[model samples]
Target: QWNILSDYFLCFLPEKQPVQIRENKRYESIKIVLSSSLSKVKFNFVLYLCENIFDRFLTFFQREEPLIHLLYHELNDLYRNVLLSFLKSDSVQQKSGQDLLNINFEQSALWISDKEIKIGRFDCERTRKLMSSLNFDEKKSFYQDVRKIYITIANYLKKNLLLNNMLLRDLQVLDHSSRTDQSSGDRIIRIARTIPNLLDDREIDKLENEWALYLVELVDRSWYIKDEYIDSNGNIQITHVASFLPAASQLRALRSMHRSCA
Candidate 1:
């Protein structure tokens, strides 16, 4: 059944050109290609097929648990190969004396950076679902493979890319906004607020404390207020070294008020 479906679908692949004119021609073409080693398939073509066709194919076997299980192994193999190709690609390699290229450090990070946090979350959620569906041995095997892939990518980025630091900075700012000064802290807080379930209670508290500490320090600095003047519109404009600091005390008080009320 899988073989018939695979053959039928192979003909539709744009990458496999010379569009087989007859059914026999299509079968023959698919047979020839399938007979050859999977290594013979182009990396980009396989990735394209996986992204476009394989997902749709899964829908057909939704009720067939056994077939779905088998397909998981096959898809895992394809995924590994595609990931290997991506890691080996010229774009991912470090360019001599050049600034790091901005690319996702992981499948999940890519989605998150694109403002699709749910997609990033789904990467882990999907794997967890798969693990739950599998037997012990299968779960162990899958877990090991996933761990290796994550570690490899992380180590590679650590050694070859500065983008990792940038990503770290983004996390720190968003997760611990209170540790940073006013403008950046406020900006991160605003952004973080929009993303529901982006951070847990511990993270939120940590960020709030970091922010409160920063505000306390700002108050101590005395540089919070730099200059004061009246604008042409007759509005009082106070220019501070860090414009966000004035609101910091108010924010701290509000947080305290909320805590007390709670």
Candidate 2:
């Protein structure tokens, strides 16, 4: 089964998520190809495994009271380990100076060098700082394991030139910025710039409502789809909210994908 699953994981790309590999000192300790970089080869491979792992975890998240909280801490531990492994890889060179996982890149000073970058709603400084410093195990706050998954997705997509720009745009507009200012014309430009990067002609033609629905499908496939409930830490209560499967950003990714097709 492991062999078969490994083979299936390899199918997403002939090799792996293909992108220009920039070596990072933080990730220097590890040497496995799939474990490093966002190569599609690694993403889909993990996606296949996470699909089953999350399925086993679904029943716990749906329960009321402390069950949901216990489940989150347990899963958060798992996410942290995955993150630790990724950080030890050579790709972690970008944020060697700080605790990369906690730095929120979009909020960084470098991103706003041009306040003239008026269109995006994201906190460029915060998002960039975070993104650059972001590592795998740092997800102590969010209850959704899928957030780690999409951050993984974002990291993998980082290699494609188109994907790189799309993500930067996301940082510029939404990563740090609140959605309350939806009235600005720059919002449309912010979104529009991302549309072209998501899908090629083929993926667009293959699906309808591709972005939103696809995320539904993606989360459902890779993780246990959760219902509305309270998120927690160990026995400690966090908050009451609907924690759906997958990183919430996946919804945006799907939307980006749909925009490309449209």
Candidate 3:
């Protein structure tokens, strides 16, 4: 039950598959804390905070696709901003020269829209009993431990993840929205470079040239318009579809090129 959040955390893992968070040495301290007797409270509290943070953070890059437009700088910037918000929280203050500095966590951009972040389902009888058993100082110590774990997880995401794989980043060129002005042609070549044997030199050059023509076609053909209807006059009218699809087109094109040369 406590590992539910940890399971969800795996969903955020990047393509290269870094060390698993469960066995990760960086999270050793967090694991120890979770193994403690009062783990129910600690786990639930961490879960509550993490749920909110991940939900908001995901809003930046998570998308439904045939096409997933990704940029390293975009995701990296969002990750930094999320952790910075967590760090800026008064609930988890910074100790400057042994003096605790209080800067409000509520003021953090992540929590701005949330009027109050209540641990809704986690506020059960067991949790209340555990919380009530702690004295004032004990409660303070408990919260401090929880805050440390929260910050640790945030920092881990900020630093040790595997989002920088050039292949994954280069795949962004496949997105229809990213193909503007034939710019993705060079990017397609770069992607081929990232994945050895994906395309040879001549093939890469061919793909790039084809991608340029594809761009011109996407514009001329109004590829974004998928649905056509007959007007009152019986003439066909085309309407623009919202999704930037035919992202698969790039893959299909590459495959065709590969097969042609083979």
Name the regions of candidate 3 deviating beyond 4 angstroms: 1-41, 53-85, 89-139, 181-183, 219-249, 252-262
Q: Write the per-residue lDDT of candidate 3 for residues 46-151, one digit (tens) a residue.
A: 5656665566556644444332334453455444444444353443333221121122333444342211323323433445566775567766676566545545
Span of ten consecutive residues with least summed lDDT in model 3? 94-103
lDDT of 1 at 177: 27
- TM-score-based ranking, best first? 3, 1, 2
Please identify model 1 stretches exceeding 4 Å from their true place.
1-23, 38-98, 102-172, 177-262
Clashes of 2: 47
Candidate 2 similarity to native, TM-score: 0.21
TM-score against truth, every candidate: 0.23, 0.21, 0.46
Question: Which candidate number has the best TM-score?
Answer: 3
Q: Tell me the alpha-carbon RMSD of every candidate.
A: 21.3, 20.6, 14.4
Better of 1 and 2 by TM-score: 1
lDDT of 1 by residue, 1-262 (tens): 4356456555555346545444577567766665443313222223444454346545645642123112323333333333333343343443321222333445533221211111112233443433344466654554344445444644554455333232223323322223344565664454335435555566666665666566556343334446788999999987444223234433443344334433
lDDT of 2 at 65: 30
Please write out the lDDT profile of model 2 over residues 91-162, one tens digit for every residue: 333332123334342232323222222111132243233333435443222113333553454354233213
The positional error of residue 160 in candidate 1, measured at the CA in angstroms, is 21
